[model samples]
Target: MRNLLILLVFFATSFGFSQELNCNVVVNAQLTGNENLQIYKTLEKQLTEFVNKTQWTKRKFKPQERIDCNIVINVTGQSGENFEASVQVQSSRPVFGSTYTTPVYNVNDKDFSFNYLEFQNLTYNENQYESNLISVLAFHINMVLGLDAESFSKEGGDPYFKQAQRIVNYSQQENFKGWKLEDGLQSKFALIDNILSPTFSDFRTVMYNYHRKGMDIMSTNDKDAKNEIALSLAYFRKMNANRPNSYLTRVFFDAKAEEIEQIFSSGPSVDVTTLIDLLNRVAPTHASKWRNIKF
Candidate 1:
């Protein structure tokens, strides 16, 4: 009977592990223009590296995972000063015993220009330009989707469809002016507002207060205090879900919750100084709490 119970436990654990969604990604590039094919190849290589090298938290994915995705880049039009590119991203993931497939993103633009000389005539100074473009794109995607180190490290497990929705929403916004990109890098807050459905700033007040008084309350063994902190965390997470680039909130919640949980589990033996420091780190937004915190 004991052997059977252990075997069952092992099998259950293995089954649960196997059920985790896995993913792979393939990139397809098609360039149309008098431009050098080498340039397209370089772009392809850069993009591939970008996707592959990105770390998405702790959930790193293997190429042969159950989830699969593809990125198709079509350079459909080109003229001396006008260059057009279209990106169609497709993704598939298993959910609740069913496989869901969808277009993650379909964006086509004609005004963007890429100089072959940029790559071919590469100089140290020009490297910054390329880096800026890559950073902008990466930041945009990261904000549009709450991608962390775990998601980017995987192949198909990356949440591309959610990101697509953010892109669509941002594009439809009245304030969305393509001209803004011309002004150099946009503010992170603006990016968050643009891509997220709910404005992140809406929770700023609550989050700030939580950081101040909430942590101290959570340190107490009082059940009511713990529940209050939990409720606050839940609310913050929900609000963050409504906006792009709110992943930082998620991270903050995780860190704060873990600290609170540790204190609870350790009882009075836990280091109060450490807990205080953690609260202080998160208290910048809640000036009142910061001022009121005693020790």
Candidate 2:
């Protein structure tokens, strides 16, 4: 009877606490001071564990359902415990019916500065600002999940975005460097706020169609899939016309510019010139890529 109970316990433990993210954290310390290089190693290990182990949502994710993401931090300066760095956060989702994984969220955050002690515990409370280290990580983790959810369903990531906003709101009290509304338009607060605004709601729908309805069906019907994606480009034009050069617009281009070039490269059924004109209008930063897509 004791052996039977132990077997049941092991099985339950194995499946009980499934996390939602398989996140990789890398701290590039080549530019930092050598006196404390070992601490950066410790930071990388602890951060990886903290992100991968923490259950961000109550939903139990199977091993295969975990969102794939990477957070790379480039340490530029350090003074004792305080460090200044830039972070590039990226996440991708598997194309439905295809082996390709499409990039969803990719943004470079330049205002990440935090203080840390070697091997310190990383704990996060939604309502409190415990540490800038956890605040920055928590904020981006939620954003990744939120953006992934948006790709799967319309307005599906509202809860996660709200949670990210709550973190930003609570962190403002601590007077953190990157948590204020008045910070530059590219700050974390502005990013989340832009996502939650009603004017940008259509862009979320565009994301869903681009991934689920568009890319997912390309294997079976490449022409129709490309047409569906081309239809979605009008949404970008509308978004940009509504709010010219918004942060979210830039975020979309940052994530999809390369993919856009790939999708339209082979003279898709949709008018290539119209798409290029729209791309130039909506995402001028990638106009060169769009011009190359011209047939």
Candidate 3:
């Protein structure tokens, strides 16, 4: 009750305009073994500022409300201004009452090839493609914001997702790997496209139910919360029956497998037998983590 009042008061009083994302951006060029680490450091600093400083949404957000996320650009090779890189994006949100924050979006996009010069200004234009660096970063940030919002309210992420889809649309025209349908099954195009497609609607439902219904209630009624979480996994079973191990499904389990194991392992006793079986079927890749579950 105290936390709720504090939050309500915060929202009511926080009329100040603030950045939407509290994100950490890292540029890891160690693999390249490049002597000129200055460029990579500069890239990291610029990206961190660009993402954290950009006002993603029109609504005002207090400091605590900023979405927590991270971006890591692994630079594998570089030649002149061109470079080969892979990007891993992760974002999470706080539970309603507890100090625990659940992972919401976790994805690593390979083939993030882009060109950059030292000290180049990074800017984002919603309607235009200035560069892959800007487009990819902005797209992920918006998607993170969208996912965070969806966890709180049903269909709350539509606008941000549409904006991300637009980013993909603009980026498809550019020379990039993760922005097109042909990039691979796990491409950024496939990620957002599958999410928005009615064929995979249950994915979004699981997002809402797993977070809002399940995790939020855990501190109050852990037993019921466990049941709610297990029920939420039923959406995955239905999605698997249709697509059978989809990219989006893999994406969910990628972020959630560890958390799922932890939740069901040492919490109030609940029948997760069906859940374990369903998980193995839908996300076989995480069989190892599922096996670690004692309960």
Candidate 4:
């Protein structure tokens, strides 16, 4: 009996250790020429604060665990108009390592631009420069690190998207009128509304319905299947507005509702087969939840 007890203790310890996150991150920064050093410094400082303040899962990274990161500010012209900022981050998992790099442009008009890989025409107003950058960086890092990419994407991909959606959703509300800009304000709201309007809503509804139907088919007429499908269908119908025909939309929508119906119908429980199959269909080029999702 003592020997069996010792074996149990050992197994428990090993399992606990395996669940702990053991990874290192690093940050670095560099600037070119005699451009606005102050701007670059501010960017670096903000980026650092953003990462530190972010809750990267629970105990996934240690404060002392050397996060080697850098920012390079390059001045292509004598004037500051030709300035650009780039951020690169290196993160390691127990079984894999990855690198993510992104470049953000700050133009003379105080406008900003960044690439989202698939969609690149991202533009932000002068007043919202910092906020936009933070939103973009957070989205990029979350997507690359295999975090809740689907949730983030559904929530308009970042804070800016959510903010824009809110303004549109509550345009008739008393406070939203105050959100108007001094110039071309109508055009701005029009663009935002165009992206999140009825057509977009319909697309999301279709994806949600497809997913629910797939789940219903797989669940073998389980009583909870209907409720589970209803919940997921409702969520995506409200959330996904911009990504029509996206692989994320397809794979997630294609999942067997029956497989997930029980999990969603009951309390939280991991559905390993559903998750693995979804990841296999949408990993690498698109998004991945391999490290984060578990049974």
How do all models score by TM-score? Answer: 0.34, 0.96, 0.93, 0.28
lDDT of 2 by residue, 186-249 (tens): 9998999899998988889898899888999998988888988988877988888788999998
Order candidates by TM-score, high to low.
2, 3, 1, 4
Off by over 4 Å in 2: 33-36
- Residue 212 shift from truth in candidate 3, angstroms: 1.0
By TM-score, is 2 or 3 better? 2
Candidate 4, residues 211-251, lDDT tens digits: the string is 33433233354334444444444444333344434433343
The digit string of per-residue lDDT tens for model 3 on 114-182 reads 999989988888889999888888888888988888898888889999999999999888777889888
The segments of candidate 4 whose C-alpha lies over 4 angstroms from its true place after superposition are 1-39, 42-79, 86-195, 199-269, 282-288, 291-294
lDDT ranking from best to worst? Answer: 3, 2, 1, 4
Model 1: residues with Cα > 4 Å off, grouped in runs: 1-36, 56-68, 76-84, 102-106, 109-111, 115-133, 143-194, 197-295
Superposition TM-score, candidate 1 onto the true structure: 0.34
State each model's C-alpha RMSD to the native.
Answer: 17.2, 1.5, 5.9, 15.7
For model 4 the local lDDT of residue 164 reads 46
User: What's model 2's lDDT at 70?
Assistant: 96
Q: lDDT of each model, Cα atoms only?
A: 0.39, 0.87, 0.88, 0.35
lDDT of 4 at 260: 36
Of 2 and 4, which scores higher on lDDT? 2
lDDT digits (tens) for residues 1-295 of candidate 1: 9999999999776544432122232323344634455656676666655554444223434444433444555666655423355444333322122242212222222223333332432221211233323333443344223322222232221354244334434433333233244423233333344333345443434443343334434434445444444444444544534543343453344334434444345433422444444444443343334343332
**Roughly what TM-score does model 3 have, to 2 decimal places?**
0.93
